[model samples]
Target: MSDERDPSPYDALLLLSFGGPEGPDDVVPFLANVTRGRGIPEERLKEVGQHYFLFGGVSPINEQNRALLAALRADFAEHGLDLPVFWGNRNWAPYLTDTLRDMTLAGHRRIAVLTTSAYASYSGCRQYRENLADALAALAAEGLEPPRVDKLRHYFNDPGFVGPMADGVLTALEELDPRVRDGAHLAFTTHSIPTAAADTSGPVAGHGDGGAYVRQHLDVARLIVDAVREETGIEHPWRLVYQSRSGAPHIPWLEPDICDHLEELHDQGAPAAVMVPIGFVSDHMEVLYDLDTEATAKAAELGLPVRRSATVGADPRFATAVRELLLERAATERGSAVERCALGALGASYDLCPVGCCPARTPRPAAAGADTPL
Candidate 1:
């Protein structure tokens, strides 16, 4: 079905995301919330939080998300859809509970949520659901009606999403030195998690189980690669890689970090390469540190030319894709099949998540308080 066939059944759309600190004073506490269960020392967290401090303790993610919210609102208005857009973060001001409370008070029910993460994993999928549950419980205590929120399916495969990425890759290719551009290898990078966690992601299906996190990323990478080839008529070599692995050394995470991959490309006599952060929505901390800072430095040391493609931050096409996904989800009746593209040759259809499909990992602390899933 097309997006124009039906407008959203949802009363409002929530821009859900991982919030970042806006100032030096907010950095340590925000980092603390993110690493709450990890048992990382406060001093160490403070040191690590220096990445945010480098940029005046501010993260570009929140601002980027705000711009996205505006774009979404504009798109909805332009298309004559009445869905109101709201913003909430897992941590920080405009907390999920508060935002949901505002929406509830405003008489919005049956909301639709769009999480910032594009892939499936404990952090990306289940954890957010758990947060939603926590929010509902909090609203119950406050004697306020909690709105039912249905999250839109992941949009990693939408033409609106992949098309912008194709443009980015082509732009990067154009920026490279002519010699390097002709022989450039493409390296697509994303967040790394414990291999075991990656293996158990998504819902169980007829194939025995759902696609794992790594598999999902590979699927998106393949689509983007193919799209790039089709668009530019250049079959540049590419590989899906992992970055931002914070797990202990004993635990295995995804392999061959971007820096390592750049070295290998250099050794292989590749003059240049384009690093596409297909796994992220914007140049978040991982993209900033791993690709722009660290990977670029490594490439410079190796004497290999490298350019990084931009993420779909505030891109009009991406905003339109989000709108289309919302309309798609809302138009389909509950328990009915909805067709959606995945990363592979075989497309799949999914119903809305069952009640307990994606369960939350850690039990939310009582002191953290309950919140509505905005």
Candidate 2:
């Protein structure tokens, strides 16, 4: 742990996330909030909302976030950090704008934001900044003050983040039958987006030259695969697969959805498969619906056993990683080059988000009193 005597620069830490519906009645409204300004029809939203209806219109994300909040508070207290933690979501109750308003009213000045996402992409990075901008604008309209907020760097490369996920895969493998464990195929899953969006995702100059999204996914997949192999002494084969595709059929999205991948493995005579949701921090709706419900059903239909690995939600190591990130960011002087702490053998640094990173397609209204570039 970094020196605790160093005066903490941030007044509070904010847990920023993508929220979900808490009950049956909230499902449509939550969906509406997510699809707002997209001009998506109510009927179409109802069709998409069927997945939530399957589980009584409740998404596990809110409960999971609550668990994370508790863990964060406990960790902060244990470390004797004075920063208070707050929760805000892009689409749900205790909304981001409202949360910011409350924080500002309570006299918080400098705040640090920790988004639930671990990667750099439009949805993962820039959109949240845009949301902050929206929230600040809203506060401004109400004649309120917006506190200055700085978001922490991505933690995808942090050992504390990756190690827990690697351990989860190993545990999943152990749960399978001996034969399956010995030769189970590993399927790493993440969300699928339009090929065009992915092509232009990062801020790297030549990023769109094909395979940026796939390549980043491959880097994390390989790290976990290698770690699992080392720990279990099982040389299981693995592949990167996509899930939760929301685009129309005309716009090509990432291929071999988790369900389809499970079917393919079964056809190839694989007796079992271990699915690691490397793309997410928790077992959110995508993980629940796609892996638990849809893919599990497919696996049952094919008589092939499939084990889904756990995400890094509220994992102790994850909290440590967040602390390390904040400390690293705080230690550096403002306007200096950001240095990324590399994960073992990952061969990449994810320090500062590059300028123009993850451009938004349809920008939302700015939040009231959000900090803006001078």
Candidate 3:
């Protein structure tokens, strides 16, 4: 049992996310932030920035994070948790370094970070930790005392996350013609990272070669499929596909792309299709542009009936789940027994990352884990 008299392990919660442009003029600079080290030219980035221009130069991510932050505050208050949540981003405004400085100045320490990304991979997990380390180092160099940032474990298989996604799939199915609904195929989509990164995502000892990235997605996809089956009594076929791939032309990324898979399904005479973005927590620019714009257009061209499902953004259940995770981790830090809440077969992820869990390409400072070579 936890001692009620003891102080909490965490002073505050930090909502960390990948930021985006909020208006037309900020679009190019936001792109520059995202591709700062990739050696991508400004001209080429401007060309890619057209996607944001098409949507009035706004990315739904920041606003979605705002809604999520509000939901978290409300949930915490309802549950009698006094932890205040602060918002920051890896790129763009309210940047991570600035947020850390503000939090320290506001007297916050031992902060728990919850990134918008929910899966395990270099980009999804390790990169965020590295960013945190960078922020702390920068603060220390400036004689600022930064808080210790511990990230919440991946929640891809949490009931709160899976529940909303399953319901979303059902709702998307309702949009299709009744005559073709029975024959609909589920296409689970996620951001496609390089094959090299995917091959080394999770703990080297237990997760095998493909690591946690592919395995976690497959587990969630199966969970969603089973949930849809249990709810609607339809055992629809499903495939875990990749999307929003961006890198050098020669690098082999995950495949087949969602658009390519849609075309294949069209040729095969599939009656209808539903896209469930199980990988992302919110409908960011990747979801809006890649799936909504590019993939939807391809499906239209192929005469394939398709509907895109919604991400779990600002859902009260998800907000409650976040609170549960925070308390659960706090309990563990206090040496108390806690039953982790998760759906499907993978079980709950580790509260703290293990050594050599998800190594970056080169050596870098990362928080909440041991970066020893496996």
Candidate 4:
């Protein structure tokens, strides 16, 4: 007899996330960390981050990460998986370098990094790997032998992740009037990156018509749509839309924007709509300001009824999914076969990002991948 839940070869689980400011005073400097080397002026960054000012300059991501950390720890402990969890951010306090240093001091030699972003894109995947390399390099400068890191594969189509989103959509539909609940169209939304980035997302050959980014989102939308139909017996209409775009006017990004899609639904006489943020794992500022604040306002202006679905924030199922990913990866590392869970046609993502999986515009060293320099 053998235990299937053993998470061996990985001494620690690191929750890597895109950090945010916790107060009005920390907003601009945090943005500076995020936008460094982009040459974006401080004034423009301030203008862009005005939404943070709306909530006392706090971005909900840090708190969300805290809750998610607790959930993951609780789930792991409840299941007898004795793994220590640590958290670090790319652009704020408890920054990656500091967290890695702490872990190194604590003698964690093998780390499994689980990024908050659940998709395959430059900003989502490779950038975090690059940051890991940078952090390790900093540790090297201080003569500290950094731990070996391996990023868990993408979980965009994992059942645990999609199931929560599907249920959230169902819940949102129930909030609408009975007359419109059956007819409320679904709008699956995600962040909008530049067209070039989207075109080159994930492995080069895997990019479909709109690229891996769009194709993955479409798969999730279909799965959720089918789930909703099975539960309610109504095959409601749906579309994959983009939101929170931050690019120059001349450059192209994913579309139609969620706000635009809402207006389209209203124009088409759709009774109501549910905005499902499948791309984001937590209700960070992007979902809060972009959907709840900006897009919802647009719907109001159009006299359209709309509801925003909950994200998989601190959801126990998501925590379980993370645990499965860890054990599965550990088995893979030990050269043992394991059952990987995923939804839709995409199957499971690669355990390790290959060379050129999600290349940056400028070449940079990335860790925890086939092309990792460390």
- Model 4 misplacement above 4 A: none
How does each model score on lDDT?
0.78, 0.80, 0.89, 0.91
Worst 10 residues of 2 by lDDT: 365-374
Tell me each candidate's TM-score: 0.90, 0.92, 0.96, 0.98
**What are the per-model C-alpha RMSD values against the true structure?**
3.9, 2.8, 2.2, 1.2
Candidate 3 lDDT at 316 equals 94
> What lDDT score goes with residue 345 in model 4?
90
Over 1-374, each residue of candidate 2 has an lDDT whose tens digit, in order, gives: 34542325777888999999988889888999998988988888888899999998999998899998888888777887767889999999879999999999999977788999877677777778788878877888999877877788767768877899999998898899986678899999988877777777766673674334556677788888889878877688999898998877899887788888988998899979999999899998999999998888889999998999999999988887777677666665244344556564444544455554555576443221122353
In model 3, what lDDT does residue 239 have?
98
Q: Sort by TM-score, best first: what order?
A: 4, 3, 2, 1
CA lDDT for candidate 4: 0.91
Off by over 4 Å in 3: 1-7, 206-209, 371-374
**Candidate 1 structure quality by residue, lDDT tens digits, 324-364:** 78777776734345565444653542435433233345444
> How many pairs of residues collide in each model?
2, 16, 0, 0
Q: Candidate 3, clashing residue pairs?
A: none
Q: Which ranges of candidate 2 are over 4 A from the true structure?
A: 1-7, 209-212, 334-340, 344-351, 362-372
lDDT computed for candidate 2: 0.80
lDDT of 3 by residue, 1-374 (tens): 23432227999999999999999999988988888788888889889999999999999999999999999999888767888899999988889999999999899989888999999988899889899988988998999887788888899999889999999999999999999998999999999988888888888775545678999999999999999899899999999999988888899888999999998898889999999999999999999999999999999999999999989999998998898888888877889888899887889998777777777888688887655221
